[model samples]
Structure formats: C-alpha cells, structure tokens
Target: MGADERERLFQRARECSGHRRTWSEADRLWTQVIDAYRQAVSGSGRVDPNDRRQLARALWRHGMLLAARGRPAEGLATGREAVTIFEQLNDAAARDATDQGRDEALAELITAVLDLAETAFAAGEPVLRMDLLDRAVAAGLRTAGPPPSAGPRTREAMGTAYHNQATALLHRCLTGTSPDEDAREAALAASRACELRQRLMDPLRPLSVWEMANTYGLYAQCLTLIRDLDRAATVLDLGNRLVELLGPAGAQPALKLRVAATMLARERASARGGTGQRRWGWRRH
Candidate 1:
C-alpha cells in the first residue's frame, strides 16, 4: 500500500484505541499499522522522517494501551523505543535550521518522553522516570519559550511536564533516599508548575481552576517538607481560595489543600516544641 493507505490504517487504529471497549481491535489494527510502515521502509531501502514519526506515534499509543491492559513491561519497552525514535527526529530537526520543524519535533519528543516516563514510573523505575521527566522539562521549556510568547498547546504541555516533574520529585522526597535534595527540587518544580498553570487559568474553565489548585497544594507540600511553614501556609491559602472559587468541582484539590495545611501545622508545631493549632482557618460555607 501507499503512504495514504498507511495513514488511513493509523487513523483507524487511533479511533479504535480511543475507547476501552475497542482496545482489542485497536491492538490488532496497531499491529497492522506498524507492519505496514516497516514494510514500506524495507521496500524503499531508505528511512523517511515522516514514516518514522508515524511509527513512533503508533508505538507510543500502543504502549499506553498495553499498559492499560495490564502488560506494563511490554508497554515500557515499546515506550522506550518510541522515545528513542522521537529523540532522533528531534535531533535531526534541530540540525536542519527550520524553526517550524524543530519546534514540532521537539513537541513530539517531549510528549513521547513524558509518556515513557510515566510508563517507567509504573514499571517501578523511579530514577529512570525522573531522568525522563527532566528531559521532558528541558524540551518543554525550549518549545514553550517565554510564557508571553507561548501558544496554548505549548503552554499546556509545559505546565503538564512541570506538574509531573514536581509530583515525581515530591514522591521521591517522601519515599526515596534523598529527602532534602528531592524536597528542594520538588519545590522548584512545583513552583514552575504553579506559574504556568496560573497563566493558563480561566474562571470559565473549572478544570483549569482545579489544576491550578492542585499545583498550589503540591507547592505547599514541598514548602512544608522543607519546613518553610510561612510560605507553605501562603500556598495552601491560595489553593483554598481557588477551591472556594471553584465550588463543588474543586473538592479534590480542597482535600489536597487541607492535607497540606495539616502537614504545615504539624511542621510548625515541631519547630516550636508544641502542638500547633489549626491556625490556617478553612472557612465553611
């Protein structure tokens, strides 16, 4: 078949993959899609960047589906392959001196890296996950540019990358061997996540508000871990305010903020050699 036929197969696979009920069909279609691309390359005796990108995209989606279907090890392997392809494409784009191609490839690379990081995390490789997240953050920054100049898609990708990085760092701080360093790094990541999400927030978008509130809670948790009680309190307050503004849609972040507030109070109490009161009053409606 031709490139157009291959693309149609890819689209069919994507559509099948969109819902859980059709995942088995998706898996079948993806295999066909992958084979089609490989056949094209073998027959042509040369690699096409566009073909490689489509292959990588297919691998990424297939990996996620595999993970969702309880085959995480396979998912991780596939995701790594996808990331490798995306990285190569991104590097080639960088050397080509075309801003459009470079940016597009960088965006794709960041997404692939981030997805692979999540797969690694799920596969119980926290260190590997963190490394991939760091790569994603770097790529996201380059693609996103300054906050003022970034388009919505770039801003969203950057915000997600920062948010995931901060969450991973915080998890390491709470559970890994390097509490101090992880907490500090988490604070930085959480701060950037908050900044990016803040810029994206709109009162009309409850999901955006919720995301901002959750980032605030993460920031507060990082601050509390570092014993920065004052700043933690401030961050918690900001989260709570956003929750209040969001009403019932904000319940998840509200709970997160409350937990962070509680942690902050405990830290303060430890510092003062006394039981800390609930000084950060959460108003009830």
Candidate 2:
C-alpha cells in the first residue's frame, strides 16, 4: 500500500479504538493497526523518528489489546518493544528539554508500562507486576512532574498511576509476605491518590460513577489496612454512594462496600470495647 493508504488505515484503526466495542472487535481492529504500521515501516528505505514513534504507539495499543484478550505472552513481547521505543524517545526528549513531544512520549510510555503491569498481575506474575509498577512510577515522576501546566488529563493520569501503585502495595500486604512497612506505604500512596482525585475533580468534567466508586473503594481499603477505621468507614460510605449512583451495575461493589464497612466497624468495636467515656475522660463507677 502507498503511504497515504497506510496513513488512512492507521487513522481509521485509531478511531475504532476510541469507541466502545466488544473485545473481539477491539482485538481485530488493533491487529489491523499493528499490521498497517508494520507494513509502513517495512516499505520505508529509511524510517524517520516520527514514523518510528507512530509504530511504537501502534505496538503499544496492540499489546494492550492482546493483554485484554488474555494473550499475555504476546502482550509481554510486544509491550517490551514499545517500552524500548518510548525510552529512546524519552532520551531524545530530555536532550531537547523544550520539546513538548518528549513529555507526551513519556506519558504514553508510562501508560504502556502500566497496561503491561496489569497484564502481569492478571497472569500471576507478581514480581513482574511490581517491577513494571516501579518503572511506571519512575517514568511518570520524571516526565510528568507537578501538573499545573500538564492539564486535567495529565493530572487524572497521575492520580490513576498513584492509585495503581497503592493497590499493588496493598496486594503485597495482603499476601502475608510483605513487611509491616508495606501497609504504611500503601496508606501513604492511597492518601496521595485520593488527594489528587479530589484536586482533579471539576464540575464540567465529573468522573464516571464507576471510577469514583473504585477510587473511593481502593482508598478505603488502604485506610482499613492501616487501621484507620473511622476514615475507612467514611471513604467506604462515599464509595457506596457513588456505587448507588451507578444503578444496578453498581450492586456488586456497593454490596462489597457494605460488607467491608460492617467488618471494619466490628473490628474497631472489638478493639475499643464497651466504654462510655473518652480516653481522657474521668469515668467513675
């Protein structure tokens, strides 16, 4: 195919990726996108940096699709290549610090790493998941620091990155292999994520009920892990409210919140005992 034809096919593939579709359809479109980009790269006598970056993006999308479709081995191989491409772009961007394109490239790199991390976790490779999470956090912090100029989307992505890290930490804690420090780290990361989510909130761009519920639920879980029962209860309540707003689809998470809240309250009560007075209060017989 000519360059123009390849470009047209790529654009169509990108557009198709944006719409809500079944997993099978998404897999097919992403495959087409990857093949188109591969053809374009093969036909070129000398590939330009722009063309290479486009190929990286296509590979990244295809890797994500593969992961979502439960093909982790293929996803891992493709994702690694995407990461290498983005890392080179990151270096180039750093050399020319004024170029906004490098920053965007780094952001996409972080996203790709995170997507692979999810796949790793799903595939029961906890160690790879942690490594990817650490890499993503490092990349995001290095390139997307302090998002006043990074805009709402960047800020939201940062919030998501932090949240993902926190959840990973929480998973570690739950595995019984993590030290006590893991719980503390999880709580801290969760708190940061919560604050970012709150900051990112805009009246014109309200989060989906599912997003709100998941964030709140994850934050509450961290609080519970750290034994901050009161805050956990409050956050859990907030998540439950969002889940309610999500209609019948939210029933499962809402039920989960209810169960977790009840368990947390019970644990707190068991720890506190039946006492009528405060800790400082002078309670007489």
TM-score per model over all chains: 0.81, 0.79
Per-residue lDDT of candidate 1, residues 1-285 (tens digit): 899999999999999999999999999999899888777766546687789889889999999888888787899998988888888888887788376676678777777888888888888888899999998887766655664565565567778788889899888776778788988999988888898898899988888889999999889988988778888998898899999998898888888888787788667776687654333232221
User: How big is the positional error of residue 19 in model 2, measured in Å on the Cα after superposition?
Assistant: 8.7
Candidate 1 local lDDT, residue 183: 88
Task: Tell me how far the alpha carbon of residue 13 in candidate 2 is from the true structure, in angstroms, after superposition.
Answer: 4.2
Report the alpha-carbon TM-score of model 2 versus the true structure.
Answer: 0.79
Clashing pairs in 1: none
RMSD list, candidates in order: 4.7, 6.6
Which stretches in model 2 have alpha-carbon errors above 4 Å? 11-29, 42-50, 97-103, 146-152, 208-210, 241-256, 272-285
1-285 per-residue lDDT for model 2 (tens digits):
666776676677677666657556766766776676677677538766676787788788777767766788788888888888888877887687454665676677777788888878877788899889888877767776764456455566667777888879877876656535787898887777777777765535435455556777777766766678889989998888777677787765676576556556655665689663212111110
Clashes of each: 0, 0
For residue 51, what is the lDDT in candidate 2?
66
